[model samples]
Target: MTGMERLSLRVSEMINHPIAQLRRSVTIHKLDTDGDREWEEVMGVLSETDELDMTINDDGTITLKWEMVADEYRQVEADEFEPEEEPVPF
Candidate 1:
């Protein structure tokens, strides 16, 4: 219940989060990158994450904002106590 919401956290802070470890893809927004080696080094850490897209931002900080329906909400796809078909007796 603590995940599935749009949140902005530092890369180090989210590295081991449950949501970050999920199989879902992630989008990184980096509006501007001044070509500073420092930011590149900072962003390089994202290599380990499942990043689907990325955009450089002026601020050298990881901005993670995502909402996954499967994680936010779940529904019972089948009837409760579904039983298998019975075989006819000879």
Candidate 2:
């Protein structure tokens, strides 16, 4: 594989690992009044990975940090949705 391909794959893995870890730690039954605190704790754990920085905002929201990618490397695409048509009366 090319160097760029390998770099892209590694970056993708780095990004995904923390998200997967957070998903594993969370459960509907485990959530309660302390859920926001728990989420912040999870973000703290993820910040240790060094792939991204996490900061808790004054408003209780999280701010994530990562280097900005070049426009050529940006690959975000929004999914297009079509509205469902109503069925005619039989």
Candidate 3:
């Protein structure tokens, strides 16, 4: 699986229980395009900045909140929207 997917899955597992206190420890490993391997270690408390919410407009536009900020976060323009694409099974 991709690094982003792995991190997301781990975080989801940690927060599955409503009253579960997430551990402050987490790590993500991946390889760069140039074939360099790297890892990131999370060592602090993670506070929720926003609640997860999504809105779908009648015109096929969508807005997702609380998406992690990282290099992998891609932005698609309005003109490039693909209506035929299948929705991800979140």
Candidate with top lDDT is: 2
Q: How many steric overlaps are in each model, in order? A: 8, 0, 0
RMSD of each: 10.5, 14.5, 18.2
The sequence of per-residue lDDT tens digits that candidate 1 reaches over residues 1-90 is 212112224344454467664744333443343334544654665544453234445754445444455634443334444677899887
Question: Who is ahead in lDDT, 2 or 3?
Answer: 2
Lowest summed-lDDT stretch of 10 residues in model 3? 36-45
TM-score of candidate 3 on Cα atoms, chains taken together: 0.25
Cα lDDT tens digits for candidate 2, 1-90:
754444445434545576644442211111233344554555556568665566666755445555534542343322234456799989
TM-score of 1: 0.27
Best by TM-score: 2
Alpha-carbon runs more than 4 Å astray in model 1: 1-9, 31-35, 45-90
Higher-scoring candidate on lDDT, 1 or 2: 2
Comparing 1 with 2 on TM-score, the higher-scoring candidate is: 2
C-alpha lDDT score of every prediction, in listed order: 0.45, 0.47, 0.38
Q: By descending lDDT, how would the candidates be arranged? A: 2, 1, 3
